[model samples]
Target: MHADQRKKLINELTALIKGGNAHVTLSEALSGIPADMRTTIPDNLPYSIWQLLEHIRIAQKDIVDFSISKDYKTLVWPDDYWPQPTDSVTDEQWADSIEEIERDQQRFFALLSDEGKDLFSPLAWGTGQNIVREAMLIADHNSYHIAEIIVARRLLGIWK
Candidate 1:
């Protein structure tokens, strides 16, 4: 693709990944959640706010690592992606999760911003996977969970 087209594509992908265009941003959705409520699992929901936050951070980190690492190893489903309900997070840990999520997103953004990288070209190490597909996956996955976090907060009567 031409430079103009590539730059536009990068901009759009960055917006999508940064979120808040169509739905609440992950950070916004996560903000102002009561500290005590982070561990509370609303009725019928399988995860707490803390679990959702950690899960998003972990998955994003994995995707970013996979995108950049030639030796990326596949993560175990449900196991590697989701945090255990039994697990508890401290206030510091919660903040750390959010920080890592943001860091990982910036990492992916840098990759997308790199003109040397071929957005459409499949990685030689993977089976027909390209940056565009991975980027969409990141945005799509994060948005879905962000919505889930909002729903959890709403269900808990914590959303304002």
Candidate 2:
């Protein structure tokens, strides 16, 4: 791809991943949720807001770390990707999860923004995966969960 086209793609991917585009950002989705409601499992929902937030935070960190790590190992499915579902996440824990999401998101964006990086080149240690693919995956995955969180908030009548 041309340099300009590549840069444009990077910026668009970053915006989508960071919730800077049309869909609700994770920060916005989490904004009005009271502490008491963070762990409350709305009826018929498989996971609470806290569970979803923690899962998103964990998965995003994993993907970002994997993209840069030469010694990446596969994470255990479901268990390693998700926190224990409970109605007891502490305020500090909730805050920490949010902070981690923001921090790791910046890391993902930094990787994409590095002009020296080849978005199409496969990682030296990986088979067919490339930075561009990983970036798109992160954006798509986060967008899906952000929508889920928004739905949960709306169901609970906490979205504002």
Candidate 3:
């Protein structure tokens, strides 16, 4: 990786992470959770808080894998990657998925540091995309879905 390029990517991801942290702390993302409420889908969707976490985790993991792996095919997930009953997850399970996602982010960043710019040539997502772009997309994607998860958790009365 180009040191300067890598630094730039790190800075971007760091900013995203910091922003997400602030949003989670200050926003109404998970503030809808009402005490004594049980799981109920606002829509007919099968996704729950846990499922969203898994979805985010899997997507991030795939991007991280793609960042370092020679083969992009191996980084993609099949249709069944999302957990069933997505909204019925226990608090502990949701927490576990969140932790895993964070760990995956760290692993991905470390891999980028190890691989440098050489590992960042464009492959699938963009015909000629670099790892920096890939990492930014990954970070941005995670922030987006995590916000949704927080909101969903609040809707399910589990965010508190």
Candidate 4:
């Protein structure tokens, strides 16, 4: 791709992954959720808002770490990717989780913004996976969970 085209692609991906798109961004979805509702498990739902938030944070961290790490090992699915669901999550824990998510997201954005990097080139340490693929994965995964949080909020009557 041309240099200008590459730059446009990066900008678009950044917006979609972070915020300012049609889908609800993580920041928007998490906004105004009361502390009590974070751990409240609505009927028929397998996970609470807190669990979902922590899971997203954990998965995003793993993906970003895998992209940059020279020696990356796949995490054990389901168990490793999700936090233990409980009603004991405190406000501090929620804040910490959000901070972790934002920090890793910034790191991922830096990776996307680096002009020296090739989005299409496969990581030498990994099997055929490229930065672009990982970015899309992060965006898709985050969007899905953010929507889940929104749904949970709506069901709980916390979101208007």
Candidate 5:
């Protein structure tokens, strides 16, 4: 990657990460609502705001791992893994977990810089990919969850 191209990639990734982080932080505040207010659901689904946070963190971790590894074949999904429901968890648990998630996201974004353009290189994911494509996907994934978080907060009456 040339100097200019690398800079562009870094800028794009940084913007995406920063925007997502802000949304996560905003959502975290609302996740601290009283337990009684959390009982309502939009579609009888049990996906609490906390569960969505965990899900997004999992995907963010995947992108960070992919950015650092060289071999495109390195990506692999673990067996017996399932998205955990966090509705039963306490507010304290949600607060603590989201703090850690924010920390990890900051570290991952730090990898986006002039020298970090290698992350944009074509990677083999049982198909093929470059960093730009991966970043875009990750960004979109984050945005999707952001919308969900917003909706969940609204449904729970904690959007304030």
Candidate 6:
């Protein structure tokens, strides 16, 4: 791709990863939620805000690790990706989870910005998965779950 095109791609990907261009950011969505509200699963919802938060963090970390780690080990499906609804977190743990999500996003953004790495080329360790595909996956996956978090908050009467 041309230099301008490459820069634009990276810029768009960064925005997608950071969110708020077309939807609420993770930070904005989670902000002001009372500590007690974090674990309150609404009547019909499958997970609490805490579960969604940890799930997003875990899944994003897995994607980032798989993208760049040479020694990536597979995490179990559903079980590893989604936290137990009964699992509660300390205030510190909640903050750490959000921090880790943002930090991993920046790490993935760095990978996207590295022109030296071909985004279209599948990593030798991955089966036909490339950085471009992984970028799209993370953007789609995060936005989907983040919206769920927003919906969960609305259901819990915590969001405006």
TM-scores, one per candidate: 0.96, 0.92, 0.66, 0.94, 0.69, 0.95
Best by TM-score: 1
CA RMSD for every model? 1.1, 1.5, 4.6, 1.2, 4.1, 1.2
lDDT of each: 0.90, 0.86, 0.61, 0.88, 0.62, 0.90
Question: How well does candidate 6 match the true structure in TM-score terms?
Answer: 0.95
Q: Rank the candidates by lDDT, best first.
A: 1, 6, 4, 2, 5, 3
Residue-by-residue lDDT tens digits, candidate 4, 29-98: 8889888788888888888999999999999999999888777888999899987778677878888999
Cα displacement (Å) at residue 9, model 2: 2.1
Q: Candidate 3 lDDT, tens digit per residue, 94-142?
A: 5676677778778866766664355556755546866767777876776
Candidate 2 local lDDT, 1-160, one digit each (tens): 7988988998788777777577878888888788889888778888889989988998988999989888888889989998887858788888999999889988888888888888899988888899989988888998898888988888888987
Stretches of candidate 3 above 4 Å error?
1-8, 17-22, 25-40, 44-46, 71-78, 86-92, 118-120, 123-126, 157-160
Clashes of each: 0, 0, 4, 0, 1, 0
lDDT of 5 by residue, 1-160 (tens): 6788777767877677556454664445454666654434456555666566666777666666665565523434542112554336666766676676676567666655536346655655424766667667767777777777778777766676
Candidate 2 minimal-lDDT segment of 10 residues = 13-22
What order do you get sorting by TM-score, best first? 1, 6, 4, 2, 5, 3
Our tally of clashes for model 6 stands at 0
Report the lDDT tens digits of candidate 1 across residue range 64-153: 998998989889998988887754568898888898998899999999988899998998888898999999999999999999999999
| Cα misplacement distance, residue 54 of candidate 6 (Å) | 0.3
